[model samples]
Target: MAKSANPLPPRILRIIQRRRELGLTQEQLARMAGFSLSLMTKIERGAADPRHLAAERLLNLSRVLNLPFLHLVEDELPEEEAETPPLKVPLYPSLKEAQEKKTNVFVPLASPMIPLGATPDHLAFFPFPGPWLVGVGVPFLKQTGYLLVDLRPLYHPQGVMVVRFGEHAALVTAEDLTAPKGYLLSFSKGLPPLWPGDYNPELVGLVRKFLVDL
Candidate 1:
C-alpha cells in the first residue's frame, strides 16, 4: 500500500470511525458542531491532531459522538495523575480581531464559571467597561464584564450583534444585511449609527450570553 500522507492517530481513527458509523459527512458534522468545514476535514483525515483541537471542540465532538470528555483528555494522562485542567475557552477583544487571530488570553472554565457553555471558536471577551456596551445600545448589559459570543458567521441570527469596523467594536441593531452596498447599523444614544457612506462593518459575533462577573 502507498504510504499515507498523514498517519492517523488512535483518537482520530476512533473519531472518524464513529463519524462513519453515524453516517455524518465532515461538512455535516462541522455545521452541526458550529465549526468550519475545513477544520473538520483536517481533523478527520488526520492532518491535525485531535488532542490539539481547542477544548470546547473536543467536548462538542465527544458529545456528538457519544464519547466521554474525560476519556479523551485522560488518554494522554499517566496512571498516577488522573486529574486534568478544566476545559478552557479563548478570550478576544472583538470579533474582528478574533478573525485576525488577535486574542488576549485563554480562560479556563473551572470552579464557579463552569456552567457557562461556550464554543471553542471565540468564547468570551476580556473584561471591558460597561459604558461601551451602553454605547452599543444594550443597556441591560451596562456593566464591565465578559461577553460570551458565537463567532461562527452566516449561521448567526440577525438582530443585536457585536460588530467592528476599522478600529471600533460595539453592539448594534443591524438590518438590511447583504445590500449591494452595506448593512444598516444603529447604535445606542452615545454612539452614531452607520449610514450608507459610513465604514462597512464586519460582524464579530452574535451575542450569546452576558457574563457579568469577572
Candidate 2:
C-alpha cells in the first residue's frame, strides 16, 4: 500500500498544532479570531483553506498566539532591502501637547458599572455625554475604565450604525450592550455610537460622568 499523505497542508497543520500548544480549543481560537466555530473546525480539519477572510482570521489568531505574522506561510522568501523603521513617538511630549490642547484622555475599562457576560458574540454599547470611545480585544488591566465594544458578532454584520447626540453624532454597533466581565476600551481615534434604547440612559449617564472624572 502507498503511504498516506498528511491531511492538512504543512503550514495549516503547524498553525493547528501551535493553537493546541497554546491550550486553545478550535472554538476558542475561532472566537479569539472573530470566526465561527464551524469555520475554525473546518480549517483545522483540512476541509477548508484559510484564504481571504479566513486568512485574516488566521492573522488575528496569530496575534492572540503571540506568534510572528509570516510564520504560517509555507514558502519562505529571501529578504530584500530592509526598510527604515518609522520614527519613534515620544510619550511625555505627546502627553504634554495633548494636555495643552485640552484633549480627552481615554479611561480604561477596569470594572463594569454593570456586570455583563463576556462572550465573543456579545455587544457593549456605552453612551457618553460627549464623544464615545470603542476598542476591541481581550480586556487588559491597562485599559480599565472605557467602554468595550464586542466586535466578535460584528464580523459578519456589515453596515454602519449612527447615533446623534445634541450637536455631536457617533457611530456604534447595534448589539453593543452585551460584553463579558470587564469591558474593553482604548485610546484609538474615531467615535462609537450612543444609541438610544440599547442601554439604561440613566446608568450610562452615571458611568460616563464617572469615567470623565478619571
Candidate 3:
C-alpha cells in the first residue's frame, strides 16, 4: 500500500484511537457531530484535516470526545497544488437547480449563536429560543432551548420539522399532506394555519430530540 501523504497531528490520531477504544463507529461519531457520514470518513482518513475545522466544530469535538480543545490544536498543513480537494459548498440558483446539479450546494442551517461544525460524532445544537418543538411539553423547555433536527426522519408523521420557504423558517408538527400543519414559529400566538402551499418548503430535517433550560 502507498504510504499516506498526510501526516495527522498526534491529538487527531489519538481521537481516532480513543473512539475505537470506546467502540464507536464513524457513523455514530458523525451523528454526534451533526454532520454527514462522508465528512467523518474524510476526517478519520485525514482527507479532511482537523486544522480545517471551524471554531464551533472544534469546540463540539472537544466536548463530545471529552478531550481538551487546546490539547488537540494543530496548525494547518500546506496543501500541494495537485493534492488539494475542491471545496464543496451548497448553493443552487433555485430549488430545481439544487435538486438537479447536486454539487457545490450550501444550506444555512447554522445560526450565529449555535453553529454546526464538529467531528461527525458530535451534536449539532441550535440555540434559537424555540417553541420550534411540539408534542413534548416539558416545562423546562418553556423558556429557551436547543433541538436536534435529524434529517433522516423527514417523512415521519407527527414528528417536528424545521422548514424554510424563501425567507421564512418555522418548526411545526407534521400532518398528512392532505391536511394543514400548524406553524410553531411564534411563542405568544395561538396555532396559526399553514397553507397547504407551504407544504413544499425546503424540508431541512426532523426534530429528533430537544434540550432546554428553565
Candidate 4:
C-alpha cells in the first residue's frame, strides 16, 4: 500500500536545511526563535506539521534564521494576518473547569488534540474541550500541567502510561508490571506507591509532552 502524504504542508524544509548548513542545532534555533527545545525538534523533524503549528511560530523562526516568511510558510497566510486567530486547546484544572469556563488556562497550540482514548468524532463539536490535565511533581513536567496523554499509542511506542483500574488510576512503569500484584509507581522520591486493587488495569494512554507554565 502507498503511504499517505506528509502532513507538514507548509514545507519549512528549506529553512531547516539552511539552518543545518549554517551549523545550527535544533536547540540553538529554538533559543534564537524563543521557542521550546521540544517545539524546535518537532518542527525540524516534521512531527509538528503545518496544520499543527501556528503561523506566528514559523514567522518567529524565520526571523531568527534570516529567512523570508515565504520560505517557512508558502502554502497559507500567517496566522496573525488571518481574519481571526485560530482557536487553541485550553488546559483545565479538571473536566469541571472546562465545563464551567472558570479559571481554565488557554494554551496557544494550534492543533486539535484528542483525549487519550477518544475518537475524532468525540471532539468534532468541542475542538478544544480541555485536552491537557494539570498535574504536579510528575517527571519532566512543570508546575502547570502535562499533555502526557498520547492519543495514538501505536504511533508512539515509548513513554510512560496512565492506566485505569475500575474507578482508580495510577502511573506505572514496565518494571512495576512484573510484580504479582498491582503497585502504583511514583517517580517522586518521598511519595509511597499505592495498590489500587487486585484487578489488572487497562492501558489508557502514553504520556508525551509536559506543558510548562507559560
lDDT tens digits by residue: candidate 4, 71-140: 4555565665333333334544433343355554443432323344544321212121133221232354
Model 2: lDDT to the true structure: 0.41
Residue 44 of model 4 has an lDDT of 66
TM-score between candidate 2 and the true structure: 0.36
Candidate 2 at residue 190, lDDT? Answer: 53
Candidate 1 vs candidate 4, TM-score winner? 1
lDDT of 1 by residue, 147-211 (tens): 76666442344445766655556565443333333333333344444434445667666666555
* Model 1 clashing-pair count: 0
Deviation (Å) of 49 in candidate 3: 1.3
Question: Measured by C-alpha RMSD in angstroms, how accurate is candidate 4?
Answer: 12.7
- Candidate 3 lDDT, tens digit per residue, 1-214? 9886867766578679767876889898777866688988888777777757876676566555655444346434334412333222243332233234444532222222222432221223344454233322222335455555443325456556655555444555555333444323344345343434545767765555554410
- Candidate 2 on 46-159: residue-level lDDT in tens? 777664444445446555654444444542423331122111111111212322433343222222122254332232333232243332322222333333333232321332
- List where candidate 4 sits over 4 angstroms from the true fold: 1-87, 94-106, 112-145, 151-157, 182-192
In terms of lDDT, model 1 sits at 0.57
* Model 2 spans with C-alpha error above 4 angstroms: 1-7, 54-56, 75-214
* Backbone clashes, candidate 2: 21
